[model samples]
Target: MRDPFAPDFFETPVAPEPPAPVEPVQPVPSFPHRPARSMAAAMLAAGLVVGSVAGGAVGAVLVSHRNTGTSPNAVATVAPGVGAPAASPGSFAAIYQQAKNGVVTINASTSSGGPRSFSQAEGSGIVVDTQGDILTNAHVISGANQIRVTFSDGRTTTGQVKGVDQSADLAVVKVSVSADQLHPLPLGNSDSLQVGDTALAIGSPFGLQGSFTAGIISGLNRGTTAPNGRALTGMIQTDAPINPGNSGGALLDGRGQLIGVNDSIQSPVEGNVGVGFAIPVNRAASLLPSLEKGVAIQHPWLGISGQTLTASTADQLGLSEKSGVLVVQVVPGGPSAKAGLRADGQASANDDVITAIDGHSITTIEELTQYLDTKNVGDRVTLSVTRNGQHISIGVTLGNFQAQPSATP
Candidate 1:
């Protein structure tokens, strides 16, 4: 199977033959102008694939690829009337009109060694403030040499990468433009989002600028992997039609508030199948302060891979705890290893089963990851473990996460 999150290259277009005689059909609306065939062919020849996933995990790909409160020193602002119960759901047209100006087209290019030879990638972005800070997916601008941002009014300007957090697949880009040219969207509370809530997506899918789609929130707290091979937890799943060139776009609520960032989709084919995921706006908001300053964000890491301890497995291993994470392997020199955490070796009975972290019960890997995300590097956390019928707490100082290389071809 092909890697689901692999970035697709623009293929050379073939000339169409004359159409057969048939009944006349209604005229279709025209789309934005695309790159010339010659330029597309050059990009294909360069073999550049943006937003490619690094692992063999299947069922997800980057669609290529915010809350309205004025976070202090942040680019995003809260909508005027978010968080309060709506009298009734507003129309999508109203939401579109309110958010269209904040959506933008991002064109990123990377040099391919030869003089003036480059490969280009296109995605979308959301304007956060008048200071020109726009939020987008890290994969959209990953390894890019030149970045161009186009506003809804058809004006294009150069963009600079302010900061990026690959572990979360989020980035901040800055452009120098007049205050009138920017329309900052209001940020909403993703925590306030419920399953079946209306979701509206606006972006440049398939290079069609100003495209819009609507759906409902399908699920929440979904787990997936980032482009950098790190686990992304607490994702918002939606039935919105997210597709190529939709990455880094805005996922808004019915009130025209920014709720999530369109990230990836789980589909058997290389297109949207009503299963899409978005990074919670709160996650981006948490990193905005550091992102605006061009500081590299470091995620707290616990270097161990494990499976959930089940009744059968626990019984077979003669373990007492039936619900917890079973430590399968611990990376050498990692925080867990340095803290003397034990994992299963040749003997399964000697394995350590983690039951809780900092007094909170953890029954599965997702719970553990969710807890870790709330922490920072160098923060000491206590892990309650059951080892060989003995319960003990181990103090481990968390470490920075290092991105694993992509295994996608």
Candidate 2:
């Protein structure tokens, strides 16, 4: 063998130290690489499977809860922005206070043949002025020898008759109360009053002094017949509580102004039936200034009983083309008779139907009276009538019914 270093051919290339044991290099990792389509499909399938089960369970619970009962939050409640509705008592109280002061309790006694004879009646009156003048119903003081008025302040005084309008059921009385205690209530315009307006009545009903009641205006321009067969025109109807002694009291508006004078009540029971009538203050006031000045009042009278022209009557009288009043009957020597106006006499002839007075169209007796009211007692008026299928005009001078005194007391 050769040298030991040169060993054998098998171990020959052992390799020169194996090339110094070449170092192996390691590769770097990238972001977790995945197949995008495959991952997305798997996630979608999982979501569908979870959503189906959860949705069904939630629907079941909602249905069960709905069938059980209403939720606590479902109850109704008033809103903070709203308030309850009510009426104001201030208006009513103020009107009552102002009107009651003008109201006075009236008591009258009529004498028979003997000194022991006594017939007493109680009523209410309104103070018209500081001069001690008072207004009451004519029937209250009718045939009375002595009359007394009691104020709310407990002052009583003897009353003297100034004058009486039997037709209107109004009378004026005079008392000697001081001016300090004589505050007259402000009068309002009743003609402008509407239905359903608030009304207040103050009086001494049943001798209960300073009694007050409240209501609303139920009607207007109502026609009422007196017990003596006299017709009261232009009456105001109300539902205010009125009793026996409320007559001649004051009917006031919400503003504490006098609107009317309480005159009558329609009741079948012992208490109020809510049907009451009053004379409009405007109508009554028109006559007040004259009476206060001691001027005699002369009421104009048409002197004929008539009625509203109904459709049937309108057709029968050939008034199909017109609307007017039909004169039923005429009194002898009355104003209409003196004016040569023909009425339904023994001869059944269709006299001319009155269609208008001056320029006003006559419809009801109330309408006719209202037209007549526009003129004075001695004033002359022209009536437009539909007669014999022709229109004719007639001039008439009104007569004073009050001027004719009753032959009997």
Which parts of model 1 have CA positions greater than 4 angstroms off? 1-89, 115-117, 312-319, 344-350, 405-409
Could you tell me how far off, in angstroms, the CA of residue 269 lies in candidate 1 after the best superposition?
Answer: 2.0
269-346, model 2: which lDDT tens digit per residue?
334566677888777766665554445666677666666777776666555434567766666787777886776652
lDDT of each: 0.70, 0.60
Inter-residue clash pairs, candidate 2: none
Worst 10 residues of 1 by lDDT: 38-47
lDDT of 1 by residue, 23-131 (tens): 3222221111223211100000000122322111122223333011221223435688676433222456556766899899888877879986655677788887666
Native-referenced Cα lDDT, model 1: 0.70
Residue 209 displacement in candidate 2 (angstroms): 2.0
Give the count of colliding residue pairs in each prediction: 15, 0
TM-score of each: 0.76, 0.70
